[model samples]
Target: MSSTLLAKPQMRGLLGKRLRFHIFGAFAVSLGVVALYKFGVAEPRKRAYADYYKNFDATKEYEAMKQAGVFHCVRPRE
Candidate 1:
């Protein structure tokens, strides 16, 4: 009981310092995770999709689909 009474003030100060450290550490970690995912995952996917479409023959596929009557000319837009 006497030890608890004497430790209250010290505990309060330690709590404040630890709380600040925890908050800042959490923020830094979250930012790092987001940056790593963007660079490692999202950017690579975008580049792969661009590469795939770079050599895709859009006009030839469109002509084939049109010849096969796979499309409906519902009021062509200008």
Candidate 2:
């Protein structure tokens, strides 16, 4: 028989041999991404928002808006 005709089928050693390891690696990578986002992005954003609202005075803000004519509205129909 020709050498080409005697070829064996290709094995899926890359993925089929160790699927569990691949799945675990993927899960670990996803968990790391989530952790990075929580710490790097979400935590800093949350801290910034908390700091902004830390000394927030609602009545002072409302007074500023009132001076800006924000409360000038037409009367409702009788």
Candidate 3:
């Protein structure tokens, strides 16, 4: 029984070539996720917050809160 023909086929490349390809692929995927988060999630959230505060009047808000007695002074802890 000759076993020469039953051997697994070998790919033509350095062993490190396959490892490098896999490492680079994983790095690319991670970078893509970070970019997606920056553009898709963080950018929209930042814009929404900016829009919400764009026309805000801090003085008027404070005055209204004061008029409504919303603030109370607390004694310092000994």
Candidate 4:
């Protein structure tokens, strides 16, 4: 391959504009997706968990704590 082909162009215009357009479009789409998930989907799921825990029984609570690796009792002193 010729060194001229690998070298940076002495003149640049259209290529830079096209690259900038694609980059900005991608950033806008990503921001829209994150905003939708935070405002639209997560609120109801959070409420359901809150309601479930509010009515949870001791046996169920103890099971959940065990699954999460949390224990109610402290270890005895050595």
Q: Write out the backbone clash pairs for model 4.
A: none
lDDT of 1 by residue, 10-70 (tens): 6547988998999999999999999999999999999999999999999898877877778
Q: Mark the regions of model 2 whose C-alpha exceeds 4 Å error after superposition.
A: 1-16, 74-78
Shift in Å, residue 34, candidate 3:
1.0
Better of 1 and 2 by lDDT: 1
Candidate 4: TM-score? 0.53
How should the candidates be ordered by TM-score, best one leading? 3, 2, 1, 4
List where candidate 4 sits over 4 angstroms from the true fold: 1-11, 60-78
Kindly list the per-residue Cα lDDT of model 4 for residues 16-74, writing each as its tens digit.
Answer: 98889999999999999998998788987899899988887988776777767686474
| Candidate 2 colliding pairs | none
Note the Cα lDDT for every prediction shown. Answer: 0.86, 0.85, 0.86, 0.81
- Report each candidate's C-alpha RMSD, comma-separated, in the order given: 5.3, 6.1, 6.3, 10.0
Per-residue CA lDDT of model 2 for 1-78, tens digit only, reads 486686676676756757889889999999999999999999999999999999999989877887777887733235
Candidate 4: 10-residue stretch with minimal lDDT: 69-78
* Angstrom error at residue 23, model 3: 0.9
- Location of the lowest summed lDDT over 10 successive residues in candidate 2: 69-78
Candidate 1 local lDDT, residue 28: 100
lDDT of 2 at 31: 100
Clashing pairs in 3: none
Query: Which ranges in model 1 have alpha carbons more than 4 Å from their true place?
Result: 1-9, 74-78
